[model samples]
Target chain A: MKQIEIGHGSGGRLTRDLIKNIFLKYINSEELDPLEDAAILNLRHQRTAFTTDSYVIRPLFFPGGDIGKLSVCGTVNDLVVSGAVPRYVSLGFIIEEGFSLESLEQIAKSIGEAAKDAGIRIVTGDTKVVEKNKCDGMYINTSGIGEVMRAMPLSNISDGDAIIITGTVGDHGTSIALAREEFSIEAGVQSDCAALHDLLTPLFETDGIKWMRDPTRGGLATVLVELSESLGYGVHLYEDRVPVREDVRFISDMLGYDPLYLANEGKAIVITSGESANKVLEILKRHPLGNNAALIGKVSSKCKGVRLKTRIGGERLLDMLEEDMLPRIC
Target chain B: MIKTQDIINHIRSLVPGDRKVRIMNVCGSHEHTIAFSGMRSLMPEHIELIPGPGCPVCVCPESDIIHAITLSRRADVILVTYGDMLRVPSKDGSIRAQGRNYKMITSPSEAIRIATANPEKKIVFFSIGFETTTAPTAAILETGVPDNLYILSSHRLTPTIMEVLVKDAEIGIDGFIAPGHVSAIVGSNAWNVFSEIYGIPTVVAGFAADNLMLGIAEILGQLKNGKIRTGNVYAGVVRPEGNIQAQNIMAKFFEVADVNWRGIGYIPESGLELRDEYSARDARKVFGLKEIKEEKIPGCICGKVILGKAYPTDCKLFKRACTPKSPAGPCMVSMEGSCNIWYKTN
Candidate 1:
């Protein structure tokens, strides 16, 4: 019998397989066909974007944010990147027995503040107490709904479309890895965990925008690969044009990780027409969350998959992550 | 301070358009830089960069991995090893696939911590790597580990394997890019025999794209001048004498001995084993484990690939029956393994 492995939850190929072979087999629906972060629904009087996410990150508290804040922002950003104005969310918590009440209150306070900043309300909630050892400290799940502002379709992507990123990548994943204290290296990196509605909402007014995605678990590389595969177009990325913090780069190097595949909580990859690329970048640069926005690459019709042009004038192919990146022995 | 592009241009100018120069890199990081940075596309058509046996996990003896899997199966034993080693396939399957009680650690010190935490369990630390990792494992042993912790060492010597490659007539490697991390501990002078006796140009290189290109340029420069010698382009970290304290620590804890590689048979003094004095802390001795008969995975060309005789694509099972997700061989398992790196960038 085939058993589930850790890679299945890594948001890579195995995760896609599990979703396809198991989840989609029983719950087939056209709404889930696109597999976008959030599903678009036609309500009685308005169109809506709905998304749900769970936060089970270890060390509940990290450098820049906590799991409470992450859950709210993660769900809110799912709607924001889907071209929607986030409205309300429902929060649920599963707490382990003997978990400290003070920690719970602190996390609750963080959730309140994050929701407030994102301009979303926690309209409903639920709680469950699991026996000790049945769960980690706590797990939070959030489902968010928003009003669709503009429809950004993958079908709109065309040849010569420019790909832009909101800011530096890998900050959130790198910070989480460091916070685990698995490695003895120290750096001043922080999690880029913030809602992107405030930063990305301006792009809704712009024209010629093709698609948008928050590069979270599988990272910018996976998102691009997925986009290319779905649209039958190719992506060419300039390695030097992709912005990464020096500290994040140092940690990833020491730990044998590729920053391109590392998670970014506050970054959104925007694909737009080449003509409007500079204008989109200008709008992104005006916001604090997108101050490091850059035009990293463009969509192409010549190649079959993602290709990266290195800083030293070499080119290579990039594939979807297969498994969790492990540290080398030497 | 030189620009990477300038180094690339210099390499282009240095290479002869007609002659085929084969340069081999004996470090996984160097290959990682080359593949990840797409350095092969930048090189002249005549110059070929071959990835040698740089990945320690790919060459870790199948017998040792089987022993680790056996030990990890015991309810009272906890097998701790480097994260990459957990995925290496053997006759009985990988430690990750066959065992329930195992932990992946990034450093040797984490083994001691795990031992302290699980006082009642037998913590077998499966230490494997080159001199760079061996020195740290030796350092951890010197500082003292808990009574419950035992070591299962499969550490290989880098220079000895390079010597084997030099003597082999079939693999005609014209130049060498020595591993910088190994040189940092064993000293850059360790590779002098290849340059002095074998008359092959060797340059110690770091993992950066520019440093590697500079190393390649130096190798071509040596070939052009007919004055080949062991050169150091990663001079900022690697020194001629290397880290003396690390050498001393390794000498204190380990002694060189004949050991079997995964695909290659036994090579004399190519591996390090714990001294007899530390037999009590040796997991093999304490557990009375013997090296099992080695078996090769059918249709896997890892043996040829590790020796630089074949490319990963040359293998029939590369992307078909074998892949990073379900690696049928050791080479496809570890990130440092050439097949894995090649598969990623291909």
Candidate 2:
């Protein structure tokens, strides 16, 4: 096959050949064939959930992990938190010309490793390259598919589901900020980039999980707002219970940023029945990734929006994050 | 290992009387910790905690940012700073909102790296912060072979502000919660002048809930004993003499000067200016911005908030008109601002 170039995305035989020869060869599963504008998959019995996300993090490599690992972990965490068992992921890559082959290989390997860790498969993918400067090294887009098992009963999510955040927020964003060539600090912060499905398996085995979500682009604030709008319920988070790393806290303080609004690559926020909350926390605490996990708040019937129960027993509204603080830092 | 409850009990014991007292914490990190950890909840009803102007970002005037932005417009100068200052807006525009004329940096050492990498372009780091950040800036100066780089130092000293606050402020504060990190550099003795002259007690407290309450306890203890003194609850990181090495470095490259704070107005000798020996790296020397005037957002109450003359909520723009997403004032824009803290955690 002819070596593909940026021209392939311009609509020609190069695009067809690249898709058929590369994408199909690797993701030759029956369900992922791109017959139309989209891949149509049949769902026989289980409830289905779908999500799409794009990763445009810079530097791409840091103390603990890289963007490839982040792309997969982020999307999988999303599916798992939404009360679904992640089954498959479709990957897309936009590469800059002159990018190193070795780096590409490493990234692909990390993606594979992350998929295995999450117990999901990369069933389909596409790749295209643009001239140097046309792309900032690389960008990845992922769409996830998950199955809501028939045997598992999903909570309709009533007024009193407890809100639990697995691990600290803002670690990944802070690590990325520290790794930036421009910024430097004494604190050693690493990206909290990992798969949370292993931690979620036990919780999924429980009977009270109502709604769950991984706080990604906008962190926990966005997640709470979504739940509040959807369930028509209120959330009261205790500022004290939220787990924030000292390094993360310091950097945010120094930069005038809030950890609550920062992004997290390897974390999940689960909302379950208040009665099952303790049991779910017990399951999570036994897992390494969730040792610092906290039951930061609970769903309330009165407030009707996201509110913070101050350490002083006062109330404050948690607003949507405004203009991105430290954009592209994640 | 110090639990928040332990601190609460200590505070309760210290404030056993029926009289009301107020304490102000000056560090931005302290503000962040107090808000995030919910430390204010543990306080007795009579003891009210107040925020200070010590947040380095909150205190930096908008004119300085305008000056830095103007210098950054120079094709040869690469503007550097910690990420927090990147988005801060000036009268003309924010360095970020204006575009890529400036670079957001993490540390002073990275500015050195950028200078090293470019070799040709002049790099000017817009150094802003208090004692915690001043040390790194001092480190860059000590390295000494300065040829292609400069620092526009807006670094302020905490003690100077404290002196101004204790003498003139009508805040009725019974004591002071001196900045813990700053105390580690300038030493506990630095605040002795304020304590001796004003007869108001001071305590250097750590950021943790227990540490803060302990500092408050010690200050109250001093009040009960009728002895005004400087106490250190953060002795682990702070000391009576402070970090001598950092002090020496700061004294070498910069000299104390009068500078205008964004909200608090001008306090004599409160800010650090680049000494003549390092004048070549100074942006004011590179670009004549000496004529620039201090301008503030009209009707903004950041000044009153910083001076403890008014609470953040007392400002007309405070949640109703100004917010973190759309800040109408400098204090509302910064994480250390009392308004920001109030908004983040009530």
Candidate 3:
């Protein structure tokens, strides 16, 4: 019998397979399209974006944010990237029997503060305490609902569309990795986990916005690869143009992790027409969360898969992440 | 401050337009730079950059992996190794396939820490790598490991494999881009025989695009002048004599022995074994481990792929039966392996 491995939850090829072979196989609904971050449903003549995400990050308290904050931001960003104005979230906690009550309270406080900051409300909540070792300290599941303010369909994406990123990539993944204290090397890198609703709200007003995705789990490369495969178009990314922090670059290089494949929390990959590219970039840069925003790539019909233009002016194809990022043996 | 463009242009100007020059890199990082940067696409069609036996994990003997898996299954033992080694498949299945009792570590020191933490458990550190990683493993041993900590060394010498590649007539390697990090320990002097005896142009290169391009240009320059010599373009880190202290430490701990490489038969003096003096801390000795006959997964050309005899695409199973998600061969398991890099970038 095939058993589940850790890679299945790594948001790579295995995760895609698990969703396809199991989740999508049984849970058949037109609204349950796995390609989009959130489900778009029409309820009482109103289009609503519904998304749910679970947080099971180890060392729940990391450099920049804790599990509470991450739980709120992750789900909110999903709706935001789906062209929705996130308004309500239902938080569910699966706490281990021996989890510290003080830590639980602290997490609850963080969730409230984060929800307030994102302009969303925790309208409903549920809690369950499991036996020790049944859960890893605690796991938070948040299902978010938001009004679909705009419909940015993938059909609008075409050849020559611009791919813009809101900020630097890999901060969250790097910070979390360091927080685990696996490698002794220390650097002052923090997670970039934050809600993207405020920062991305302005882009909704702009014209030619094709689609947007929060490059969270599998990072920017996976998002683009999925986009290319789904649209049957090509994504040409200028690798050097993709914004990466100096510390992120150093840590990733030292650890044999690619910054392009590392997870980013407060980032959105926006696909827009070439004519509106400059405007989208300008709007992103104006937000504090998007100070490092950049026009990284463009869509093209010349190729079928995602291709990267390296700094040395060479081109290479990029595939969706297949496994968890492991440190290379020299 | 050499621009990549200038180096490319220089290489273009130096190469004889009609000649076929096959340069092989015996380091995973070098192949990674070449594949990741799409350097092959930038090069002339006549110039083929082949990835050689650079991935230590890919070439790691199946017997050692099987032994490690068996040791990991023991109730009193804990198997620890580099993360890259977990997914490599043998007839018995990968260490990861067993799922429990094995811990992935990034450095050798973590083995000591784990050993120290769990005094009751027999901590078997399944150490595997080339000289770059071996130096650190040797250093950790010199520092004195805990009583419970044992080492299962699958360390292979890089220069020895490179020698095997050159001796293989079918591969036809015209030049070599020697591994940068390995040379930092083994030194550029270690690769002298390639240039001096074999008359193959060799250049030690760092993993940067411009630096690699400079190395390529130097090789082309030597080919054009018929003056084959080993050159060091990564002088910023790799020294001619290397870290003498590291070499001395390695010499103190390990003795060269004939080791079996997966897909390839035993190569003389190609592997490092723990000395008799350290037998007490050798997992193979402590656990009375026996080597099982190595079995190759059918239709997997990982052996040919590692020796640069064939490309990943040449394998009928490539991307069809073997992939990173479900690697049928060792080459497809590690990110540093040529097949894995090819799969990711191609």
True contacts kept of each: 0.86, 0.27, 0.86
In angstroms, give how far residue B109 of model 3 lies from its true place: 5.0
Query: Which of candidates 1 and 2 reaches a greater TM-score?
Result: 1
Q: What would the per-residue lDDT of candidate 2 be over residues A232-325, giving only the tens digit for each residue?
A: 7688888878999987998987765678988887888877889988988888888999888889998888777887776644456776665666
C-alpha positional error of residue A231 in candidate 3 after TM-score superposition, expressed in Å: 0.5
Backbone collision count in every prediction? 0, 8, 0
State residue B36's C-alpha deviation in candidate 3, in Å.
1.7
Q: Judged by lDDT relative to the true structure, which candidate is superior, 1 or 3? A: 1
lDDT of 3 by residue, B1-346 (tens): 6677888989888888887999999888899989988899899777889999999999898999988888898899899999989999888888999746999998999999999999999999999999988899999999999999999999999999999899999999999999999999989999999999999999999998788989998999999999988899999899999999999999999999998999998999999999999999888788888878887689999999999999999998888999998999999988899888999888
TM-score list, all predictions: 0.85, 0.79, 0.86
TM-score order of candidates, top first: 3, 1, 2
List where candidate 1 sits over 4 angstroms from the true fold: A1-45, A97-101, A181-188, A324-330, B72-80, B99-125, B137-151, B243-256, B274-288
- For each of the candidates, the C-alpha root-mean-square deviation to the true structure, in angstroms, is 8.8, 5.1, 8.8
Candidate 3 segments whose C-alpha is farther than 4 A from its true place: A1-45, A183-186, A324-330, B73-80, B98-125, B134-153, B248-254, B274-291
Clashing pairs in 1: none
Sort by lDDT, best first.
Answer: 1, 3, 2
Give the TM-score of chain B in candidate 1.
Answer: 0.98
- In model 2, what are the clashing residue pairs, if there are any? A81-A212, A182-B105, A183-B105, A183-B106, A184-B106, A184-B107, A255-B84, B150-B281
Of the pair 1 and 3, which is ahead by DockQ? 3
